[model samples]
Target: MIPSGHPDAPKLSPLKQLHWSKVPAANTRKTVWDVSEESIKLDFNKQILDRLFCSKTNMSRTGTHSTLRNQDKITIVDMRRSNNIGVLLSKYKLTGPWVVDIINSMSDEHLNKELVTALIKCAPTSDEEQLLQSYTGSKNILSPVDQFLVEMLKVPKIRERLNCIQYKQSFDSLFEEIINGSRLVERCCQWLLKAANLKQLLHLILNIGNYMNSGTARGNATGYRLNCLLTLSNTKSLDQSITLLNYVAKIVSDRYPHLLITSDPLLEAASRIHWKELSNHLVSLQQGMMTVQKEVERQQSTVGMDTFTTKMNQFIKSRLDHLRDAANIIRGVEQLYDTVMKYYVEDYSSPEEFFSLLHNFMTMFKQAHLDNLRDMENDKAIRPKIVHKAERIMCQRSLSTTSLPRVSLNLAPQQEENQDTVRSSAAAAAAAVGSNSGSSIQTKSKGLIKNFKNIFLRKR
Candidate 1:
């Protein structure tokens, strides 16, 4: 449920506030938002970092790419003018305590002044930071920088960062909070699966799916998205994955309709989309669409230039306008489905083993939980009625059954009348409909087909 404004909501921390505050800027005449977009985009670089840090042969502390003494510290910053992330190291590494060590002695105002002055001199939001970045400077300036630096700012990533900053209030330990929240939420979801009534669990899943598709949820929704996929990934091993995927897919396909992307950031990334895998979703509908077009073609007999695009569109949807709409949905959802299948789907030879793994996974989830949702099953009983509706929809998909065009034919009685009369009558009708004069009939048919431009053109 969407929450009403909470009057006594706790204040956000500085870092959290900075990352997520949506401050409205007044416009001279036009309404303009004075929000700044600052973010860090991670791509294939993380894989490299993971290689360097997490490698078995690595000498770094834990799985970090950079090795520093325990006394050393690193800072994560955003100094790239193009809205990319930046990293700076202090030989050791920077922790909360280290950051405090650097500026704790200074007054809050003084610290603010130094940070602001450093930000101003380093780079504009649209410009590069030359201070910590230059190779041959005076060793360093008197300010801090991130431990890692990356360049590249996707417009969507920037928008996401801005939205996160605006919506998420700072907590004491954001990382811990995220970790704790994620584990507890995922675990509670599992308990609800077995303990609660089927309808209740479905509602929770639907609600989470909705949160994913909503704009406000884009910030923290990734955690849950990952959680859900990871939970479902073992389906092949546990038989739970396929069943749950079927259940979840049915629910989303039937009810939510927007669960594949929106709030799921990883799904929004470009390279993650798999066009071939998603092709299965269109097969059933395309059959219907084909039937529709065949009838239309038989009746009108026309064709057009966008024939390929039209046929492909009809492969997923029937009506031209609905085809356009469905295309948009497919394009938007494709990336997400690709990511899920790529990361999660596993192969299994038997269903028993798969379900065994699922039970083990649920056990692990229960142990990892940080927060306890009381009477999860009981709470689920209070779930909105929509869950039941969604479940029913799962069994009887509206798309599965479609109305086909009715073909009507007139039948004159084959009475025991004179056989010659029947033959003559049939012969006359055939002649009128082009039984003889084959070449002339062909010419007339050509003329008729020529007149039927759309049918010939739009090969539906």
Candidate 2:
């Protein structure tokens, strides 16, 4: 048999190993396992020596390089353990070519808002920066993600660029909120000033209230407070079946059916805004601009900070103009709000309060209108029943009072024939009485129905 160490030796199977002891002693040779084990030990020793030599070379090149700081070591360890850099690269689909383009340009315009925000969260620390700056190892030894970060750190003032991007994003969001809120406030004010149907409805309410309070000290009042609208549901008829608001709704439906004064979506959106909240946002925006200005001034002398400062200067100039315009809009909104409040004789502390009160009043009015319609429907359905009952009662009474002609069967045939004629005449008279009673009952029922409706509308 060929020696186990021969170049052409077949690999030993389990069966071959089991039968090895049965082979002749003269042909015996070392098995492949012993040679393979010795080769593995030699390879391991060589790898250790190579690593030591590389370490010595790295130290000699750096000339007594300082040991990795504790923080730096921890950062590196965490990077290795979590692979967060890899995650970020994968999440943003940042290929090597795209990353190189970004690093070379040093421009964040290609990055979306979300990606920029994420990068801010994962910004490299100073410890990581030192480590990356001193790193002299081959790029192949580092991960693709780490290599990307190393290249990115080569750009000067990258952190400043990111901060500028963040500031712009924040300014945009805050400005948009302020602008939209101002527009909504403006719309609400315009609606209040120009809504003819709303004015007419208020006038009608005032007239009705004055009429109801005719004999009291409240009589002949020129106007009522807007909040007084809330009390309409509390004022009820003697039987408590209908409220003053219900009566008002009925009047409106009859006299001005087209008036729907409370259905403005702009008013609803305005009611949700708090003036104080908007004012705070405005202040924050101004403060943020001041901070940006300070940053730009501080960085004016920085060698590589020119791009950031220049861009910030332009931003400040343009946005300052916009900020001034926004401030004017806020002031205009406040002025309009105050004007509307004074016009209505309202004493609200804020626009939100004023609009919320109006919103509540509208809700109550809509409910009352629906209730009035339902009550009217019920009244209509019951009216015919009342008239029919009245006619039936009248017919019964007339039949009971009328007498039938007496029939004399024991008398002669001529007498019987006369009785028949009498019967026919009595029947005709009764039919006439019934018809006349029905007509009179119909007239009475109509009067009763009118009185019933009046009762619901009558003041206590």
Candidate 3:
């Protein structure tokens, strides 16, 4: 590598020389000839090596471009003014006067997304703003675009105005999405109340619990909390091979087959609704409107901002009406949710909690149903082997009846032991069922009235 500041070496860096060496000799010769002809025609500098080695960073650091760099105080403003401003405006087909017109008129039709984004990025910083404001030089010395930028920065809250325009452009579509979400909440409430199959399934779960808790203190309960549904999967048989959820699914399939078929399309969507996030969106919408209103008032007091203020005034009026409608819809949804909670006699903090509980129960129930079917299939596959073994043993006993009398006598004790084992297993299963049922019932009965009242009053 060549030393960076070596005076005796050629002006070109070793890196550049290596790059040029790789180029075909014919092309290099033609390029040099072209440069010489151009120099003769335009009276350009003859020091081609010096020109090739020169770069903006090298010139700025050495004060070679002092006129552009302003002695050593190089900044983003200087870079933009020297290099980027003209290309940016030309590429976007914009002129200084046209940009001023667009900003003053607040015409979103002319200000597309890309242009707005670029303007936002180009907003002057605090230091740049101070520098531009302090400059008392003749405006004639600055380019038209640079002069426009200086004047534009003089307006108060220019950045806020640009951001407000972007928000306004997207406000309608965003508001519509929020409205649709509220409507979805309303539909979920309606489905919970009016779905016949869902009601029947809950009733079935209640009956199953009552049957399991027979002869215990919780045997005769008429109602249970919705939260108890989540515990069904936790209540397993003594061997841990079957859960209460499995039993419920098996019974539903054998008896009320229609309950297995979910016709309501809203369950999946409702299961995913996050009430807190939805609430936050509503809050943001309100805050955004207030910001827009404040901007409009500011514009109304300023001269030359009449067109923007007028346009925003109309926008605010229409949006306020839409927001009022949305408010009514939200209120109706809350009322519906309150009614559903009352009808079910359940206490939940939010709609999301209630829907999520139900969603989880349904998912577990489906999985248990699938497991039961698989077990039945396996049992079917094993039945033939069991039958063949039993038949062979019976034939042996019949053929050697006289000799096997002693064998039969010995087998009687084993048969009794097997029966005892079966009985113990049954007792253990009943104990599990009773324990689970009692715990769920106890949990449901505690703090019922207080929680229900708190949740209901909060909703109101």
Candidate 4:
């Protein structure tokens, strides 16, 4: 943390502030020791001086103190011009204790003609450089801005700040996500591979699809698109009362119950993640691990960083590296899923789409099975009534056929005798009417009587 009144105190972005809010406390239970950089500048300066003196003694025959002085000046100049070091200073902020240590550690032997030359370029023009020179006092002509930038370029100090600030927390968060995401993907893959029910479901659908397309161009298709499962409910039976899917569902429920159980394990997988999303997570994890590895390497080479580096290395080996094997399994799972999709002629190359497809199929398949059971129940309820009605119609037909012959033979002769009797009564009524008509009708009746008497006499 920067001190309250420091002029170079770096302002934090809202995003970075929020990120730091969730960071584990620095003093929490952790394996890596956070070193006290309370007097790092003084300590590092003494080390540098001791090293420089040893080098001077070793090269006493070949060079003077002037050569060593010139080498130190070149190092300071290189720091001032480095764009990478400049960027790190901007990103991590430069107002902390690390910045103070770096700035105060510099001495006149390290500052030389090149440092003055680089400082001249820090301002826009000669006029500004000269104007700024007054701020640092005449004895020390480098402007405050130039001096600040020069101090920030101290590689060892910057490295130490980076190592100390957020490395452990960042590594911990990234490693946890990678491990969890990889494990999820690996589990999903296992469920898919071992799903006995999913395999049978696919096989059943394949056979049905081929049967439906028999004698057509599609009859010999090796497999069907996974999306075709969605259309199963659309396959109408011959009577148009039920779908083909209903029949298949009934068969599965009754005959192949074991095959459907495979879907139970995959239930979580379908609900929780998509294939593409999981893949992307794994990729990000790989990149994050690589970054942590680079950070560890950087800190390992820096002097006075052994404790942090050792713990960090141990953490990676024990906790994070196992994810590499899981990542490999993820790759294999992707390939297998892709191959299965291709076999079915489905374009679903990602887990996201595939899981959704499977979900839809399962839902429809179960619904179809239930519907078929309902239809069977209805058929059972109506069968006895239909049978009773049919029997009643058969009995009525038999009675009508048997009575027809009896009506013709027994009733025909009686009908002829009744007709003859009716004709005789009509003739008697006509004779009575003629007797009451008077003389003309009486003469005609007498003539008819005489003719009848003569005919009776001849017959005798």
Output the number of the TM-score-best candidate.
3
Query: Which regions of candidate 1 fall more than 4 Å away from where they truly are?
Result: 1-281, 300-318, 337-364, 367-460
Instruction: Tell me the deviation in Å of residue 69 in model 1.
Output: 99
Candidate 2 matches the true fold with a TM-score of 0.60
lDDT of 3: 0.67
TM for every model, in the order presented, reads 0.15, 0.60, 0.62, 0.42
| Cα RMSD, model 3 | 21.8
* Candidate 1 least-lDDT 10 residues: 9-18
Q: In angstroms, how far off is 149's CA in candidate 2?
A: 3.9
Choose 2 or 4, whichever is better by TM-score: 2
Evaluated against the true structure, the overall lDDT of model 2 is: 0.69
Instruction: State in Å the error of residue 46, model 4.
Output: 51
Ranking by lDDT: 2, 3, 4, 1
Residue 176's lDDT within candidate 4 is 59
Error of 3 at 76 (Å): 8.0
For 35-57, candidate 3 gives per-residue lDDT tens digits of 57557677434345445544322
TM-score of 4: 0.42
